[model samples]
Target: MKCFQLVRSVLDEIYSEIPLQDEAQKDKAIKDEILSLRSKYAKLLSSSRVIDYENPITRFSYIYSYVTSHANIVYNIIESSDMLCALMDSKKVSMTSIGGGPGSDLLGVIKYLTNASKSPTLRCNLYDRESAWGESWSDVDNKLENPFKISIYFQQFDVGEPSTWVRHVKYLSSDLFTMVYFMSEVFGNKTTAEPFFNNLFANAKKGALFLYADNNTPDFYNWFDELAHRNSLITIESTSKNFNVNYDEEKTDLGIYYDKFGFPKLTANIAYRICQKQ
Candidate 1:
C-alpha cells in the first residue's frame, strides 16, 4: 500500500476515539491520547516516502500536479469574498498555520492580499513538526516571487504537544488577530487544536478573526462543525471546489468515494469561520 493509504488506515482506526458532544471537555486524557497518535502518524509518513528532491523538476512535479487541480478553485473562493480578504489583511494580524504543508496555502493567501488595496503589514508564522522528518517541509524562509513582501516566520513544533505552545503564544502575544489554517488532517486521535484555540481566543483582542480550513473528510467535517457551533464562531463562508486527490487511483490507500463521479478527479471542499472574541 502507498503512504497515504497507510495514513488512511490509521485514521480509520483513530476516528472512533473522537467524542461526539455539543460541549466536549478539553481534558488531559484527550490531549495525551491525541499526542501519542500524532507521534505515530509522523513516524509513518516520514518512513514511508523518500522524497525525490535531487532534480528540481521532479521535486516540483508533485506540487505543480496538485496545484493545477486545486489552486484555481481555492483562489476563486478566496477572491470572491470581501470579508475573507479583510480577515487576511487585518492590521496587526498574527497568523499561525498548523500542518500548512510547505506553505502553499500561505502563498495563496499572500497572493490575494497583495492584489488587494489594503497593504497591511503582516507578520505571518507557520508551525509544523514534520521538518525533522523531511527537508522539503515549510518554514518562514520559504519564499515565492511576490509583489507583497509579507514578513513570515516559521517555527518547527508539534501541534500535539501542549508545552510547545508556550513559546508560540509568547511569540504571538495576545493583541493580534490570530488565524490557524489546517490544510491536512489535524483532527486525528492526536491533536492539541481544541485546547490551543480555547486558550488562544481567551487571550485575543476583541476583533480577532480565526480561520481554520480542512478537507471535508467525514472525521474533520464533523469535528470542525462541532467546534464552530460550540464556540459561537459564525461561518462567514463555506464552499466546495474541484480539488485533486494526492494519491494515485491505482495506489488504493483510500477510495475515491464521491470523487469518482466527477470529471475533475479531486475537489477541495473548504470551510471558513470569522469570530469575534466575546
Candidate 2:
C-alpha cells in the first residue's frame, strides 16, 4: 500500500470513532484540545507530572498530532533501512512497542510489511499506561487487511513502576522492540526509568532487534546510547533528520486543526537508532 493511502485509511478509521457531531465541531475541538495537550505533553517530556493521559480527549489530541507524525517517520525509517528490511523478511515475527498508544508503531509496521509484500505471521504487543488506548488500537487492528495473520495484544503496563515490569517478561522475548518517541517522555524521571530499561536490555534475547526513535534531543539520544553501550547492544545504524508532514494531505480533522492553529505546516527534528543485542 502507498504511504499516503495507508495514512488516509488509518485516519479514517480513527475519525469515524471520534464521537463528534460534525466535521467543523470536531476540527475546532481537536484544535483546542491539541493546543492544551501540547503544552502538557511538553511538560511531560521535561519530567513534570502535570498532564494526565487518562482522559480520552487528551489521548485523542495526541493521536491527531504526534501519532500520525511519528507513524510517518517510522515508515520512512523502516523503508530506508536495509537492516529493517531483512528483519521483516522473517516468516514469523514478534514485536513489542513500549508506550505505543493507539497503534502508531503498529501501523508503521503494517505499512512496511504490506508494502514489502512479506506475509509474516506477526504478533505485536502494545504496552501503555492508558488502558483506553487499547480500545482504539483494537479498532485499528480490525480495520487492517493483511495476507498473513497479525495479532495485537494490549497491556496496561507502567514503565516507571518496577513491580509492573515482571508481567511483561513473557512478551519480552521478541524479534523486535520499538520505543518510538517514548524515551523523551520517561527521561524526566531517569532515576526510576533507568532500572526498567536496564532490566529490559539485560533480559532481552540475544540477537533481538531494538529500534529507538524520538525527537532530536541530545540528552534523550545520549541516554539511550549509553544504555545500549552498557548492555553491549551492537549499534547497527543511527541517523537524525527532519521529519516533515504535509498537513494538506491529511484527510481528517487533524489537518483542519493544524490549519486553524496556524500550523499549516508541520515538521519534526527526529533521530533514530537501530541496535542488536549481542
Candidate 3:
C-alpha cells in the first residue's frame, strides 16, 4: 500500500477503536462527536479555552475530519521545498513535530519518501499534550512497506503548562521541524506556546529546516512569521494555496464514514512556509 493509503488505513483502524457496539449506535456517536468538535473549534476561535484531546470522541472527531488532508498538505509543502527534498535523500532524517500527535506530519514525510523511492531511516518525535494520541499511530511502522526502518517517539507536551516543554532537550537535535495546523489550536495561549518556539529556534541544529502549514489566516501565519523573523530563519518559499488531495488516486475507502460525516476535508486553503536555520 502507498503511504497516503496508510493514512486512510489509520482512520479505518481508529474508527474501529471508537467506543461503540453496533452500527446504529456507532453512526449516532460519530455524528454527535463531529458536531461537538465543530462547536468546540468555533469556541476556540473566539476564546482562550483549549479543547480536551484526551476525550476519545473529540480526538476521533479531529482525526476523521482532518488527518488525510493535513497529511497531504504537509507532503506537498515538503516535496516542493528544495531543502526538504535534499533532506529526504539523506541517509537519515530526524524530525520533531509540534502538536503532531494526530500522525499527519510523519505520514506526510513518509508519503514524500515513498513517492521518491528513497527510504531513509526516519527518526521522528511527535509531541502533544494528549498522551492518548500516541495510540492512534503506534502501528505506523507496521503499515509502511519500505526497506528502511522508522523510529517514532511521542513526548507529552502541554501548551498551557510550559514546564513540560522546557524540560525536553532531546528534540533540539531534529534536522527538520514541523507545525501542521497547530498554531491556531494554541493561539489564545501564545504566552505559553511562544516560549517553546523560542527555545526550539534557539537550540535547534544550525542546518534545521522548519515546515509550517496552517489555515490561510494571519491569526496563524503571523505567529509563524514572527518566530522565523526573530530566529533569523531563511525562507525558501512561502505562499497560500488551495491544496486538494487526489482522492481518485486511491480507491474510495471512506464509503461508510462519508455517508455519516458528509466527507473528509479533501481541500483546504492553507498558508505554508519552509525555512532553514542557517
The predictions' CA RMSDs to the true structure, in order, are 14.0, 3.3, 2.0
- Residue 151, model 3: Cα distance from true site in angstroms: 0.8
Best by TM-score: 3
Once fitted onto the true fold, the runs of candidate 1 whose alpha carbons sit more than 4 angstroms away are 1-74, 88-92, 132-146, 170-184, 190-193, 241-267, 271-276
Predicted structure 1, TM vs. truth: 0.56
Highest lDDT model number:
3
Clashing pairs in 2: none
* lDDT-best of 1 and 3: 3
**lDDT digits (tens) for residues 37-151 of candidate 3:** 7677656556788777776666767877878788888878877777788899999899999999999898888878877888888999999998989877777888766546898
Residue 99, candidate 3: Cα error in Å is 0.5
Q: Which lDDT values do the candidates have, in the order given?
A: 0.45, 0.76, 0.80
Tell me the tens digit of each residue's lDDT in model 1 across 196-220. 6555655555555555544444455
TM-score of 2: 0.86
Worst 10 residues of 3 by lDDT: 246-255
Ranking by TM-score: 3, 2, 1
User: How many clashing pairs in candidate 1?
Assistant: 6
- Candidates 1 and 2 compared: the better one by TM-score is 2
